[model samples]
Target: MSEDENQISIAKIAKKSTPYSFTVNILAKLHRNSYLTTIHEKKSYVLGVKNIWNDHNGNHATLNIIGKAPLTPFNLDSDIFLASSEQIKNSLGLENNPEKAIHLGKIPNVDIIASPNIENFGRLFITGKSGSGKSYTVGVVIEELMKKQVPIVIIDRHGEYSSLKILEKENIPDNEDFFIKNDTEQKYLGGIIEFGDINMNPGADLGIEYLLAANVEDLIRSGSVIIINLRGLDIPVQENIVMTFCNRLYKASTLREIPPHFLFIDEAHLFAGKKKSDTVEILKLSAQEGRKFGHNLVIITQKPQLLDVIIRAQAGTWIIHKLTDLNDIKITCNSVEGLGYDADEEIQNLLPGEAIISGDLTPNYPLRVKIRKRYTVHGGAGYNVLDYITEGDTLPKSEIVEKLRRSLSHEILESASQEIISNQNLSISDLYHQIDALRQENQELKQEISDLKTNDKDKSLIPEGEMKEKIIDNLAELNSIPLEKINDKMMNLMEERDDAIINLKDFEKERNDAIFQKQSLELEMSGLKVENEGLKDILSKEKKRADDAVALAERAVAKLKKRK
Candidate 1:
């Protein structure tokens, strides 16, 4: 075949021993590209394209090739196989403008590129086991989209996206392609990428109210990325907030003329899992109808089987990394069309950064792809206790303790605040009951004190001798007592009565003060009620004025139309 021709017909293999390794005759100058594959012995072998060599004098050409493994030599036959870059590109249906396409990574050992366009926004599902570089791959995609100025909303369940603020330190010692030059200080390389973090935890600087009050659609339309951090929040609260936000976003997207926006739900299975929740329902609805409104959903989950099957089916693209679960592997195999049995085995053995990409974005087949390195700092790194202890050695013990104390105190205060808010009304009712009981007790004591005082006055009016004689006569009827002993008893009773009177007086004063405070509280409450009523009236008047203004504007527009 001539070099000018777009199509090259190469020699076919006579026999093959294995699936990945096979021999084929070099019939023409066929350069290595990902699309070149040899179907031998009822199995496919990816003919890894290495390089395209042409004669310096334009007299000859050389084709260098590689494969997944070493190949056994086979007889070269007259049978011809056709390979064409134009045919491959046409089949892939890639975008015409490279600038619009986000570069994921290069196709393995091939000149052919794999960049999905922005217009291809739809449900994208990424699944992988933990520590398999799932979040890292996601970071790469997010950075690419950010460079394109596409707005992203991430449901950060673990506070993993906060590190997007720090510049990524690429540590590929020998790979210069991954390194960023010091002179090139860009947003992707550590400069501040503008993002709003809405923390679900009450103690955080930004709370749920901020998220609710902010114009989410406007933020996205203006190309702002928002991260809703659900870390440190109860599962129920997380679910409620996620459901509400998604519902609002869907409604707003439907109402407005806006640019395409992406909603990335990390750990998506929590929201759209086996158990039913409002969040799951909202996600389902969004997955079904969101694409039409330019609202794309990117779901990242480790548990593919646990995810809602309908939502999974809605995905137009899937980036599957290393998964060990048999059920998850089966589900993945079934989801992507044209994934071979051998590919299923390969899924279990895939390296951290290696993945199999399939769906609408691929070339009508599952493609083995090496995920590109991230441009943003990876926030999902695992904790190392020893490393933390060593780092702590640099600081004074007191300072470290103070920092910990502050953190703990803030958390405690947040917990206390939430508890107080939940039970404030109940606490007021309990206080009212306690105060009422005290008032009733005080009234009973006042009556007893008054009776005691009257009795003392009656005793004082009688002659002392006559009172003594009466007490002795009463005591004598029960048991005879000496005159001196009776006198002492009478004296003790008088002293006890006086002490009771004094205590009663103190109780009365306390009761009067309580009554006065109650009266003051009542008056204050009445004034508040009146003020509230007045505010309501003002609000109604303002609403009426707004309606009238709208009516006047409508009338003016109608008159202008009539004149036209």
Candidate 2:
């Protein structure tokens, strides 16, 4: 075809065939060296000069280029083969190393090789459903990288990677024999692999200074594999430790001139979830900026949808295994390129240990392949209840169990104590109400006593003339009563009335004193109420601490049981 014909616009292509089909067909024929570059609304092709080769007859011919202009579509084949080793080297800007490529696994008929370079650090992501060999694949990559003398740090959420310390043969369970060494022996690559367990129990020492004193950076610089076990830690504590460690590591990397280090976070969604957290923020920053500081992140998680978009976007290499959940599959497909309808079907049908590899680490395509075996032990296997029962083994040490029980007991006691305090507060409130009612009644009684005193005073102030007339009538009716006897009787009655008035005044004074005593008691109760509220606050804090302690202890117990 003429050069002009080769440069037809997308508008013209759509006239002859649908844009989607035409674009796919043209991309299928595009050479590896040719890239679709867009300028304005016109699509142009840039072919590598090196790709122009002379034939054996010394005759040179240009390869056929097919595509429409305006829109340069990417090849949509999900099962495209990877570029050769030399092509990969050139594409990734790496020196050609015949032995650097480690055999990852085989596809339908071809073996797949992956050579992870330092330049592409902090860009690998592996995800799969549980029991689909996610951890196992991580082990394979770690083993290969260790042989390459790359420093690695594993954030082992479930204490799985600790078995990296043991030889493969030693770590195999007694009830199962899965690995068999063949006659063709792989190279025995060794390095300094160490296990460090940070106890995250509530009272455990988690000071950042202690972490610095552990010489974590020195060990990593020496090419050691450090596995940080966070099995029994509370979620908050785990997040804190991971965040602190990453921050420290980032700061350290900035100061020291060290070899590139790889950080592998297994179950990474826990740390870099959609929710905002200190751990998530730190991990996002690390993923974006860690490359310049010689730090790389390899995040592994089963739930890709739960990870933050920014964190997922930073990954340049993605190894996706079988995922049954449609939402998860949709998320994985969206995150990656060259994966669509056919790829979706393939993902669902993928067997355990099989995955589709994509990203900058691979060629401009997705390669479906089975993951290779690990030289190290896979420590994150599911427990078999049958084995424990059939083996007739007793329970392991009960120290963790006992500690958990005690913690729960302590929490319960604190809760009960808080309840009691709450009840006392209620009682104090009721007492205040009662005292207020009593005060109201005392005021009413005082008014009634005042009314009685006024009536008594009015009765005592009756006219003397009327009193004399009444006495004279009584004396007349008797016709023989003496005036002196009458007068004496009137004086006795007046004296008795005055004495009664004095007694009523004394009773009013006593009632006033009783009201004063009640006011004092109410004041004391108010003070006690303030103290109770203070006690409640203190108890709330104590209860929270106890609850956290109990949660950690319970996790420890569960971990112990799983080990047994």
Candidate 3:
């Protein structure tokens, strides 16, 4: 090659601008050491790293990593994955008797425990390079739960993880239980309520309330998963519903037996926020006490930074996937260390479906595990639809349409049900097919229509402020009430009505008792008056008798005198 050509080629190669293909097997791995040294903002520290590398001349070049392992650095060499993550801790003289957890591999061919445990109760943390199966990991676990009869409640955003049909490509029983499909072939889990929609407009409130009864029922019953497909929703709404859902379930669970296993929050960072969200209290219940109550939670996310320390700390179990980001690795590992555990050295370099499981969920040792394969029916066989479509020919419309229609119908049903449950007054006017406006002017009055359309342009519109003010004034004048306080007023009115009903019943009972007493008193008074009158009549009669006797005596005396 010419000198100039060689120089240009070398420069391109150095910059990694040249495109080349290789068998790149980027694995997801973890280490408790990867999660090292955390300082509240404004704190800084150095970390030690081994086997750390960067690309140089299209070859792997090692870099100097500042790890808290405090391990002494050896001479610079290409043995990058050799520096133990623990060395840094020792260098810093921060020693603890961290029990040995499971030693995990990058990729496992079987389902094995990362930490030996009665059950994997630890928080499963998902992290990976882009397209490295971060989302796929969640789908895999969910499919497993579906098969095992363990139910889950998911706050799914982005619609990525909820696409169970992709698994059907390999035919693993994706429809044993079904989420209703929409008219557009979008399928959601049947009765698995969704919270918000990102695709629709602002006013289309995703009816979370619609799921209240069924959702609460599901929790009480247990053994059924409530998958909430929260696709196309804004960030704040996602946070609110997730936090709200978990909190509500916990509060309710305290009063009753809740569903087995807690919930899964996919893309958790959105709601985890910069710090712990207002919903942290709810999340804390599931994270800490879920297992004791037969409830468990799984939070899947590629972005670990959004998670607050409480979730990170309480998750007890962490199924950490591959995270190459230095910050992410440090935070995930150090978060574990804070819990008085000292085993972050071995699990961070895992491949797809492999993680260093930690916390109360796993054994003291990290276990290497391969997720079970999903079949088409269990949300499809955990295969990519794009790959299936690309590999095969399309079936006839007859079969295709039926399949698509079935899926879509199910999704629509699920969606509509969710909406209705969420809003008692939601205007579910109709479920008509989406259609374009009709334009049949061929044999009609085209000119008249055109003229009317052109002539009826009204530009004189009132300002929104004026319109709002008028509405407020009119409502106030009519009802002597403000719009803001309507709900409170209505509630008060209902309370008063209830009280009035109780008062009326009591009053009727008291009046009946008083009437009985009055009747008794009248009877007694009448008897007394009658007795007194009878006495007077008897005395008068006696007096008359006495007077008659006196007359008789006088007559007798006169008779005697006559005889003499």
Candidate 4:
């Protein structure tokens, strides 16, 4: 190779004289820990890859200055060379700058560990496509934190993290009942606090108001791994639960009611999106100022493009996985530091369980990490399709027949039974119980008044008559206003409850109708798929015939040419 081939000036590279491929090759050939010699404002300074970039205007190697860089008079155009180990040390101006780091995983094919600096672990934003192992990586992080005894509260939308209770994946039972019932029936690594029903798995048993009034403190005080499971609930109900939780947490943090802990929110884009909402407002406030109050947020989402701008900007760390969407990639590149347009290709090509770690966590440079395996079983690994193909052998034929009969007979009843047992129902029932007690008391009081009247008319009790009269007057005054008000309020609540029940029933009917239509559509789609295959066969035959005709014409043309 000629010396000139290896002797491209930084100025020429910056001015688009060097091709993009050549520039990439040069950088790739440089030592991993090497520093680039560049001049800014006539002052010589060594910069890292994060501070350098291949210009996007054309094939220029000009750096896209991110945080700090000279605007003009930067003249390090001389031939670029790799900085020695000593030179890199001197450039960084560090002797022994050491701190704690959280060991995440190792770089593929390298012994060097990929652990982020602990002190700068402020807020993390984790994003990836569905099934890209983003949640699995979160499990790995949580397990590490658990070892450190750092409190964690997860806003689990799909109830995937419950598997964290087990020490490791191998402890999972092999019984089908274990999977069916969603039970581990084994010792847990740490205490698991659940606010929702055990039967339902993931949902708010009571309304949002009830949770705020009751469970928020319990959630804050519990040092265990807390999971606010919101699976299987309606979107509005989920929003309400999250809104209430955020509001309480934000307010309490401001008052220093809770200690420093991690709050991992999955599907963060749903709560904090382009549209403004009460939930969004609280989340924004938390992202902006909650760090000061020790309320650290770990926002997780599959869609980075939809996440709030303010919240995205506040994240001190980013764990990006594979993303195919153009907008998602664009937003991720723009949001994260030490990344550029070139990084998009790497992101798109990232394998499952692999991620690019950037930002304050890894300040020196971005780390391409293969996420370590989880200690706990991954509940999010969806059911295998093969499992359904196997025939069931557990039940006798008679038992199976009985079960089928029962299911068929109770189909409508089972649908009704599926309604969530909400706190609203309990509250209405309690109100009625109170009203019934009040009525019984009123009847006893009336009977006593009648006896008192009879005794007063006969003069059998003289002194007691005046006292009885006073008591009667007091009772009348109390019943006259307060009792009437209570009755009116109870009646109003009952009417409202009735209306809500009616609306719920109508919604259920609509849902059932939709399900029926979906079933019908699926059957139609099956038929259409079979028909489509038949059509494809006929088209292939027609294409073969046409090819034969074209071949015959070509031969005929060759014969005519020879004759001429």
Candidate 5:
């Protein structure tokens, strides 16, 4: 092999480069959608592939600029070699191995680690057709993010992400069984926000506003995850819900009301598609400006073509899976900054669970990664109708009995408590009414007795004197018996009221204790947030010092070479 053989055309170099490697074409590619693969460099020494394209004066080749070794300007016909994998890793800052980098999966010889801190405010967009494992890839990313304790809120359009709370079961539950097969430890403090009566495990059904303002913010601030399940909702209602959430979140972020968090909207096309609506407008705005407020949006959809154009273009990271539609592929290629014709072709042939992660998330070049498996159960798995016909039931009778007993006990206790309170108040009111009626009867009896005595003294009814005395005596005996019975009943009622009052006081004390604990936790979270910000500032300063040192060394080397 002569040295002359190495000097080849730009197209030949791209063709001969290792499979799955990305290249930047310097000459303006005759495509309006050329902005698809642009990557902005953070380091000054790094060759920033500006979206600007030079005129095509026969500079048709692209250079695989991965290594840090600077090269002098060369003509299209000049000999240029591809960088080794090790050099590529070092140039992309992978050699230092930052602790916060998220492991996305692996490429050929290197693991793909994404540093969200290095990206454009953690905004990621994912797209693939159905069954292409886009959702699975999202789950993998979410699992990795969970390890870092990042607050995550997911707009689960199909109620699929609820499984993130539970560990994956060893066996699928029987079709007729309503309970999860295995009772495993919960992965996270996750909750589901729903409008309907259906409630899942590990979470209470919360309304949209209450979840957002009261529970969701608190939960996420405490590093918990929440899913806003919109299953069984009308399209318009779903859109309205998403709109309200996005608008409120953006406003909250702008006002610094909530801490930095990630919002994952699955099936985003339904809300912010090609249609020009409020959802599209707010989503587009959030994608563009939410980064400043630490509001990261991870938009997922099966159809990129249908998603809002502005939102798609604003994504800093893209995890692309197999896309058969030409328009979807075309949109992806155009939105991504550094993708070329070769990468576009690879997108079409990618296998399930395999994705091409490009944009700010990658290390200069696009990486084809085999997404790792989920740590939790995948709720979106396809259901088999035949499973219902099995003879044996997966759920044990004992477990069912225990579950029923617990549920019934809870309902009974709650009902009994309410009933007790109602009875106590009603009994007291009835006693007061009975006492008032008895007092009026006693007064009337006294007046009648006085009148009868007056008539006897006037000699108007001497013959009936004996009959009157008998009537008076009988009336007094009847009143005394009735009064004694009322007093006994009142005493019993007073005992019940005293007992209820004591119970109420105890319940209030418990509630106050819980509130105090909540306040303490919130204060601790605030302290942690302040500490985190301080550390981030220190890291930023250190990074600047390192960059300055590198710049100085490069200049010194250049001067030494000039003297030589």
Candidate 6:
């Protein structure tokens, strides 16, 4: 064959080996909604497809699910799915191809789609690198389940899951279920799991074992969705929570027709060791048993490759979002068989929210899924004081007046300001009232200033905040005097009273330190004096004996002289 003939053959083969997209896209008109498909570098939502066929030679070509720019008043059931690389959160980026996005209308992505017949996928295994939306995805699912009245138990190691329900209280049981751990009534609510609160002897293990058993008793019978969120836990604490929860869940699940709960483990790689830790071993058993007993386990980790081989083997579903690690992708994808994952040499090219979903949810192998927009806030878990709020900057007038009368606002604020106590001395309800008053006062002041700016009101008109301050000072001064007089004696008496108490606590600590030092010095001085007294006694006795001896010698000399 000639060199040119070889080149021609190579070109023919190259032309024939064209790449194809399996993403299902259908262009069908649904109820009167103008629709267009625009696919971009990050995200996609394919709602429905119009056609599925082979272009030629049995090569598959489906309607390429394309994305439309986010439409306002979007149809809840829009036929076309939208995709984009742009993220709802700017801080988070996709591990896969940023050029394409995955947004399937309300379809469960592979991560959450497969579980026993239930409202949710139940237990989940979230795998991703740090800051790769593992916890974020878990929180979003929990938030949804919680809205549906799911009773969630978060074994919070870093306190991330502790605040999951803070913003959703109004939608819950009298706002009681959404309690914060460090909030004023948190101890009373029993969220922290303390020994004394549970009536255990001091320093006992809080009978967590018993709590687990009892909690299972209640949940299994009730057939409620008990989401045990395990996120932000260090490796040790994570293992303990998993160990206890899995043991109890397995026991309860096997014994009852209905399983007590679903278990969600975050950073699953830390505990999913092949060496078989007791915790991991039991968890593996429970994950398998959960399928039969209606209990399910979802392991979440950034390094899915490191998860225990047996447990990963039992996973009936595969939700492959954009994974950056080649080893993780190889381990996770290869670990499971016949799951529709588009594996390639460049695995990192896939984008966020774009996942290859397969397993029980999909009929044939896996399908590419693009997640839809959520109404909940998605800025990943961090403390925002506003998220815990029920009422915005303001409250009712009656509540504010009541707050002032019950605890002196001055005393409460002073206590916090002075650091007299470690906690805010006022009730949360009281603080809310004050917050409302401040908000209302601020609003009124703002409105007044705005009016004054345009109305050219009299200069004599003082702002409400300033007016309130002046009135308070005048009233305080008047209250200090008796009989409407200057009352020098009373003024002097008050001055003495204040001087006597000026930072008594500060002085007390200092005085205590000095007293302790003085006592120690006195002890040392007494010991030294006793030693000196003993030395003096010994010297006095010796001196007495020496004098006697000298007298005796003198006597001998006198006798000799007399004889002479």
What do the candidate models score in CA lDDT, each in turn? 0.63, 0.58, 0.47, 0.63, 0.60, 0.46
Please write out the lDDT profile of model 4 over residues 1-564, one tens digit for every residue: 234433433333233322111232243344332345543445554444422344545332333222244445343234454334444434432232333546677665534456555667779999999989899899888866665556677887766775664444353235422122243343233244534433345222222223334434445643456676665454555666677677788888788877677889998987787667777888899999999988899999988877889988999889999999888999999989878667888899899999988887766556678887665666662212123223652211212223323443344434322322222212355579879999999999999999978877987555777978998999998878876578557645754664586498569957987998899999999999999999999999999999999999999999999999
Residue 463 lDDT, candidate 6, scale 0-100: 79
Flag regions of model 5 displaced more than 4 Å. Answer: 1-63, 67-69, 73-86, 95-98, 109-121, 169-187, 190-216, 381-564
Candidate 3 residue runs with Cα over 4 Å from true position: 1-118, 165-209, 213-215, 218-220, 337-349, 376-564
lDDT of 3 by residue, 39-84 (tens): 2123333222222233542332212223232222222211122222
Model 1 residue 554 lDDT? Answer: 100
Instruction: Write one digit per residue (lDDT tens) for candidate 5, span 473-511.
Output: 999988777765775576457546645754885699579
For model 5 the local lDDT of residue 507 reads: 96
The lDDT of model 3 is 0.47
Cα lDDT, model 2, residue 112: 30
For candidate 6, lDDT tens digit of each residue in 88-151?
1110121233113222223332222211123325445556556444565566555444433333
Q: Which 10 consecutive residues of model 4 have the lowest summed lDDT?
A: 393-402
Task: Give the TM-score (vs. native) of candidate 2.
Answer: 0.49
The estimated TM-scores of all candidates read 0.54, 0.49, 0.43, 0.53, 0.52, 0.42
- In candidate 1, the residue pairs with backbone N, CA or C atoms under 3 Å apart (3 or more residues apart, or in different chains) clash, namely 32-49, 167-190
Alpha carbon lDDT of residue 444, candidate 6? 100
Global lDDT of model 2 = 0.58
The best candidate in terms of TM-score:
1
The 10-residue segment with the lowest total lDDT in model 1: 191-200
